[model samples]
Target: MRKFFLAVSLVLTSFSVFAVNSSHCPHSCPSGTPSSNFVVFRAPYTLSNNATTKFADWVAYRIAPDTIQGGRSRNFRADPLLFSSRTLEPDDYTGAHAQIGTDRGHQAPLASLGAFSDFQALNYLSNITPQASGLNQGPWNILESRVRGLVQGGGFNEVFVQTGPLYEFFFAELPGANERHTVPSGYWKVIYTNVNGNIQTAAFIMEQTTPRSSNFCFHQVTIDEVEARAGLNLFPNLSGASTVERRTGFLRNDLGC
Candidate 1:
């Protein structure tokens, strides 16, 4: 009987490991919802109708779902099983080609993740976007730099960032390898700052394109909008942000999407 009980215990332990390792476990925070197969981590705060003001609020991707990579080349769809969102449309801002003069910019610049050894992971199309070459490589990069500086200065432990496409007036669809094609009008970014051991979050959203807009004229948005659209909170204190944020961002940026 003792031997049988031990055997059963081992089986149960193995099963638990399997469940966590299976890649099907929900990794998101608004708990009880089905997990996204590819979700690496879920944020803790619930999605609010208003944009978030904190800089440290953000969500992290798990693993990419197989469905997105198959030869079909259909519209990339995030599996509902893994995430809970009012909208599941492909991240339109990422990887979409811009007009003849525009460049696809990355809010989370690829260079930011240079420290990671698995550099290929940072090349995934999911992390890219279309922006004016000057802007993307300029002010956008500046923002990233500023944030990193803050982290290094010890002003905060971790910063949460939520970014997305900004669509203003519609434009004509461009032909591409995939069926649907349209350039996002602009982009939105929200940041949550963890300062003085208090979880203070700040958000910044911007619309970068307008006929009269100068390269430096990107408009910042409010926190409420970000939370409503992103459907997730900014930070949960599992690991210390000061050490983990830079490390994880560098890993994800250098490795892939």
Candidate 2:
């Protein structure tokens, strides 16, 4: 078991390194502080910790038609699981210059998890970030709606969505008193589906500042780009994960719907 775990870890890291365009960090991203692997899995999604940045390294969830049947509206709040000292509060984004220019963006959106508690859980501060007003309400939102449609319309047996933020090497601060909170320069989403015995994946990234609003496919990229930029090695427990073929384009007409 020990050796097996070790081997799996090696393959997972190799996937992060080998799949990326460089053995070194990307142009603007730096490894100033390594992220945490403290993972917590819940009804809506699973997230790995990045306490230094006070956000999840990544948040992944599986959505199906039944998942969005019903949910109650709830307000965003701090994650009680994290210590108060290290967690973000409602005030963090409030007041002058604070979250003015940005929106309290959802990494894994609330609507994706329609059950009462899970829906509310998506509002936890650990899952929130400051997103550019335009990006959040514009192209980013349009694609999110499209993804939800694809699932709720029975587009696939199941769709797994993983999302998270990315920061430049030095990172940026939220405009308020909570300077500890980092403002992501960009965000990413990866969708995976298995239909008719075929596995298909589509991954994308867009700057929080100037994401394209007209075309979703314009930003589509290989999963390699997403993982490398965030410095995360996802799904190490899956043995064949490393062998999955990485593709740069979406299979629209060929998606075997």
* Top TM-score hit: 2
In model 1, which runs have C-alpha deviations exceeding 4 angstroms? 1-99, 171-175, 210-218, 228-257
lDDT against true structure, model 2: 0.63
Q: Number of the top candidate by lDDT? A: 2
Candidate 2 per-residue C-alpha lDDT over 1-257 given as tens digits, one digit per residue, 9 for 90 to 100: 54554354345334433322111111111221242333444567766556667777677777777676445564889875565554588877775234356777888777766654457778888778877777888878877766777676546656777788888643346655454656678888877676765666777788866644646667787777777777765433333554542565554433222
**TM, every model:** 0.49, 0.76
178-209 per-residue lDDT for model 1 (tens digits): 33334555555544443464443334444444
What lDDT is reached at residue 70 by model 2? 40
Q: Note the Cα lDDT for every prediction shown.
A: 0.36, 0.63
